[model samples]
Target: MEQLNLLFEGFQHALTPMNLLWVLLGAILGTAVGVLPGLGSSMAVALLLPITFSLDPTAAFIMFAGVYYGGLFGDSTSGILLNTPGNSSAIASTFEGHRMARNGLAAKALATAAMGAFIGGLLATTVVVFFAPTLVKLATAFGPAEYFALAVFAFLAISSVVSESIVKGLMSLGVGLALAMVGVDGPSGTVRYTLDIPQLFDGMSIVVITVGLLALGEVLHIASRIHRDPAAERVKPNGRPRLRKHDIKKAWPAWLRGTAFGLPFGIIPAGGSEVPTFLAYGTEKRLAKRRGDIEFGQIGSIRGVAAPEAAANATAGTAMGALLALGLPTSATAAIMLAAFQQYGMQPGPLLFERSGDMVWALLASLFIGLVILLILNMQFAVLWAKLLMVPRHYLYAGITVFSVLGVYAISSSTLDLWVLLGIALIGFVMRRYDLPLAPVLIAVILGPLAETELRRALTVSEGDVTTLVSSPTTIILYGILLAALLFSGAKHLHRRARQRTGDSEGDKELIDA
Candidate 1:
């Protein structure tokens, strides 16, 4: 009840005419960017970071929250209609969503995605409102060792579990950690990797790295395959999406299950929405009727789209919790938002709650409003958004690349930054080509310096006593969890490989017998 009253107060602050306008503007812009393949919320937020410098902090953050949730809503349109997932979280949605579109159920797919996201967003925001204060209090009690351990847990969980291969994931993390080392050492105040370049003194801008990898790298990757013939486009819906009674029955359970899957993972440090979505999808497949009128993939199981969409938006909301209280970013979009906060001379930690309480509450309030706005816009305009698929691939990617380069250059007016963009672009291109996950790299880049700084601080405070690193119960528990995750992941991979080999051997024996 107290939390509800505080949230109402936050609404009072967020519902001001100017703040509402910013929220609407952010939603519009976020939707536009999200509809464009390769330009996700991270890139959108990064581009808008500098522009927010002149605005009130509350208004700027409200706009950013709009962009974040708006992108999640908009990305599904592309995934369902164009078979191009605007955000990685929407990847699973593409499987059943595009299939549904091809079967002339495009409207249904879009509706479900939008509504599921709303439900997820609303629930997650509620979670944030009730839990954020308590979490902030607990986080404030954390020592440097606990914080360092938390960083390690984030790094390992995200890098190891999210990617297809652990080696590639670790390599991406290594690259990001290396990039994070470019600036002068904080404790020693000595240059580490500046190479005497003046631009290096300030370190590589988050805007540069984000735009380079996500936007430009994605553009270049698309360009490499532009010559291939496009797939037959899915038909767009001409009327409102109607859910049959049976469809509703099926979808409701999926919605509940998906929300169940999402809420826990959102609060935990698992890698964004990917794991939850996959888990939900797999669970739905297993729990589905053994003999059903509708096949799992055929006719588009509502669970397929609902689970991932819910997980995606839920993760986004909880990610905000992590960022605001713990100074951690669980996803790329969150990282960019963190950079935006820093750009505005605000550090989002315990002190932030004390100093910027109203702003924080207002941001949370805007999320609830944003979810409602998203639901209306998505349901009403899904067909129109589907029409975006008609855009020529070449033109879309070309414009993105141009904008990416322009956005980066505009930040600092440095030709050297352009060079760095190209270099990172090449690196990103290779990583994508090899099927490596980019999230780990971004996570490492953002968290590496902080991890290092905190570790050193902990050690200094303990006068080099190694036991001090785990003196606290929280630190010990966090490290234990990290260890368990590593072992579990390793065991799973080995078992999967063994199963594959066993099947291969059986096939060979059959061939020999024949």
Candidate 2:
């Protein structure tokens, strides 16, 4: 009841016309920033942290929260339409989202992403408002062993994309793991794969790898095939990209399920929204088979776009909650926000609410308001965004490459990164040509280090005993879940092969009768 009262007071502050204007401005700017490749909410917030010091703490936090949610919306838009994920969290959406656009469902994909993000953020934020402390405690319960198990879970969960071909999928995962090993090892203070380069000591940035492998790689692959496929061109959105009632109805359940995946990961240091979004995508694919949905690989299922978007934003909500309530940063953006808190002479933890109760509640309330504003900010301009495909194919891809290279270089202003990007882009082209999956590569790059570090920590604490990994209840549960997922995948594969054989035999019988 007291929380509810404080929430109402929060609304009182957030609803003021001045504060509302700030939310609107932040939402608009955030969406614009997110449309750029490799720039996400972390960049958006970092850029704002310095300039917004003039505003009072409540108003400043309100705007920042608005920008955070708004970035998710814009990130999805570009990921779906252009196959350019603005952030790693947006990567899962591109798996099906860009395919949906290629099938001339850009409007539907856009609507699904927007609505799903809104539902996820709204429910997740509401939960945080009421149970921030409890959620924080649960997230903090995860130790090194639990986090290692969670990393293993993420590796297996990506089997959704792995279903195309086991050999090729594993190959993609191996490449990611190799790239992840390039940095210096933390425990032994030894460099493994830096190759005597100073810049490589810190490791390959996810931003550069993702932008290169997805956006620039797509450009090169298409260029290589443009001669054979003379009609290769950007997909044009079929109609005004407005949200439809049917799309919302089909997506609400996915939104809810994705929210469930996102909420827990938000409070845990398990590599941000990437795992939940991938897990949500995998679960929806499995459910689609049960429902006999055929839109998956050929024409992109709406569930694919919906579930990942929801998970991403839901994680965003809980990340903000955990940051304010427990001082734990679950994402790169949240870590930057933690730094911003320090810059503002604020410390976030158990005593945060007591010291800055008014600002805290107001920031939470503004997050709710920000969701609505972002939906409008993105949806109203849908037609204009769709028109981006009107440019010529060659010019369009060239522009994308230019923007991507520039954005990547801006990260650390390194020429080495540009060269590495070209190399990764070539590798990506090869993988695409050979029918290898890209999602597993991304999943490994994101979680490989976490898995390595956690496993080492757990084993060292147990004095090199291998059993230390599975001794905990959380580890037991995680491994149990992984086993179940593998069993289900094997059954599905066998069933598919049997169905093909049966069809082939029937065709042979018909040929004999003829």
Candidate 3:
């Protein structure tokens, strides 16, 4: 009941003219970013982090929340029309969505994607509103050991389980851990890795790392491959994205089911929405098959488009909750949001609600408004958004390159940052070239220091007792989950290898479905 009152107060702030305009602006910009290939919400937020330095934290967060939700729907547009999903989270959508477009249901696919995102985001945000505060209570019980355990769990889940190549993911994580340690040691007061450079004492700025990696790195990568990559061809959407009664009836159930699939994963740190999205898609396909009405691999099922889009947006909404309640980032975008909190001199955890309750509530409330704005922009005007592809790909990437340089330089007006930016951008290009996962790097960089600090703190408390790390029930349970995840991932890996050796091409489609 008290939460309801707080939410009502939140609506008061979200409904203000300036805040509403920011929400609208974020929605537009986010969808545009999502429609473009090789860009995602993480890059968008990182590029905008400098703007946060000047705006009120509440307003900045509210806009970021808008962009986060808006991008979920936007990525589906490319998948349905051009068959080039902007993010992995939208891969499942393309399985049926692009097929639907090819079958002359382009507008229908767009409508289904938008509607699914709306339902899933709505339910997920509501769940977070009521349930996340409960997590704050649980967070208060965490000691350094537990926090360290949780970070390790996150590291393993993202780097080892979620990525395609375990070696590549772990390598990316190792690089990030190394980057995180490149500065003066805090407690020891020993300068390390600075190379006598005064600017290196405070450590590499998170803003520079984020922008360089996500925005500028992507720009360079795209520029490098522009001549080699084939152009994307999209089915032109002819009609308004209006759903008939029959289509709605078929899709409504899937939206709810997908939301259910996605709600819990927001807190799991399982490397973004890809897992839940695939689960939702697989479940819908299996159920449709049982009914002898499978529409996949044929004309494309509306349920197929509906479920995965819903699950993706649902996961995104819940990820914000996890970010606020525990300072946990389940996806790259949430990882950047965690950094944004630090930029504002705020640490998100049990103390966050006590410290910034009003802002948190307002941010949550604005999500609903953002959802409405996104639905309107995406559903009726999806074809217009698709027109973004009309711009030459090279030109788009070139603009991004210029924008990233200016944004990074504006932060500190330092030549050293520009040098660092180019170096990191080159590293990012190599990481992408080798198909290494970027999320592990971001996760490691953000959590690596905390993990190190917590380990040392635990050691201090236990007088160098190594067993103290797993002494608590919380640590035990966390590590137990981590072990289970590793075993499961290993079993799957071996099974996949065995199947490949036997020339089982039947499983290839499932691999691509995710």
Candidate 4:
């Protein structure tokens, strides 16, 4: 009941003219970024971080929340039309969404995606409003050992379980951990990897790392292939962006299923919406198959489009709750947002509600506002948004490169940062080239310090007793989950390898017969 009153007060602040305008602007820009391939909410937020330096933190975060939600809406647009998803989260949507477009159900796919996102986001935001305080209570009980255990679980989940190959993911994690080791040691106040440089004393800025890796690295990668990859042609919607009667029957149930699938993942430090979206897509497909419907591989199922999209946006919404309530960032975008919170000298967790209750509730209220605005804009102007693809590749990437450099330079007046940015961008290019997952790298960089600090603190409290690390029930449970995840991932990897080898052997025999 008290939470309801606070939420009502939040609506009062969020409904203001200036705040609403910011929400509208963020939604529009976020949609544009989402429609463009290789640009995501993380890059968008990183690039905009500099511009928000002079603005009020509440207003700035409100706009960011809008962009975060709007990005999910926009990514599905491109996926459905051009089959080029803006981020991994939208990859599932592309499978059925693009097929729907090919079948001339382009407008229907757009409508389904937008509506599904709206429903999922709205429901998840409501969850955040009521359950955030409860989550905060849970977070406050975590001690150093528990925090360390949780960090280890996050590392294993993202690096070993989520990636296509555990080796590549762990390699990416190693790079991030190595980078995290640079500069002054947190406990002893001893400089470790400064190379006798003054700028290295304070350590590498999160803004520089984020913009370099997500924005600049992506720009360079795209520029290198601009000549080889043909430009994506714009695909217009076939009709009004309204769901047909048949689509409504199929889509609403899928939306509910996807919301259920995604809500919990937001609390888990499993990286991002990709995992939940994939799960939702698979579930929908399995259900459709059980119903004797082969729309998956045949003409494209609206359920496939609906479920993954809902899952993606639902995860996006609840991810914010997890970040705020627990001071844990479950995705790359949330990691950047966590950095933003630190930039303002504000740490998220139980303390956030006690200190910034107004801001938290207002942000929640703004999400509801942003959802309505995004749905209206997407449904009415999807074709216009798709027109973004009409821009030439060289121009789009060049602008992105310019913005990345400018955003990084403006934040801190240091030539060393530019050098660091270039180096990280090169690393980012290498990671992308080798198909290494970027999320684990970002996760390691953000959580590495926290994990180390907590581990050291736990050891000191126990008088250097290593066994104390698992002395707590929470720590023990976390380690158990970590072991289970590793074993499951290993089994899955082996099965995949076996299937691939079998396929290859059959191909060889077929060739011999031929």
What TM-score does model 1 achieve against the real structure? Answer: 0.68
What tens-digit string does per-residue lDDT give for candidate 3 at 193-308?
88899888888866567557765676677678766765532234446578999999999999999998788777766447776776677667657755877476578999999998
- Model 4: CA > 4 A from native: 1-121, 226-367, 378-382, 502-514
The best candidate in terms of lDDT: 2
Task: State each candidate's clash count.
Answer: 0, 0, 0, 0
lDDT of 1 by residue, 1-514 (tens): 8778877888999998999888888887887777655455666677667767789888899998788888877677766765555666676566677667656677888888987888888887788778876645543576778768867876887666655467887988898899989988889998878889877986887656755676566666766765562453224353456566877777777776777767655545444665566556555654553445265567677767887788778778877887887788777788888888887788987688788888888999999888888788888887666554445656645665675666566667899999999988888788878888776776677667778988999999999988888898888897897798789778767887899999999999999999
Which clashing pairs does model 3 show? none
Task: Score candidate 2 by TM-score against the native.
Answer: 0.96
- Winner on TM-score (3 vs 4): 4
TM-score of the candidate numbered 4? 0.65
Which lDDT values do the candidates have, in the order given?
0.74, 0.86, 0.77, 0.78
Give the alpha carbon lDDT tens digit for every residue of 258-334 in model 2. 98999898999989999999999988877887798888766998889889999999999999899989898889989
Order the candidates by TM-score, highest first.
Answer: 2, 1, 4, 3
Q: What residue runs in model 3 are displaced by over 4 Å at the alpha carbon? A: 1-121, 128-133, 230-367, 378-382, 498-514
lDDT of predicted model 1 = 0.74
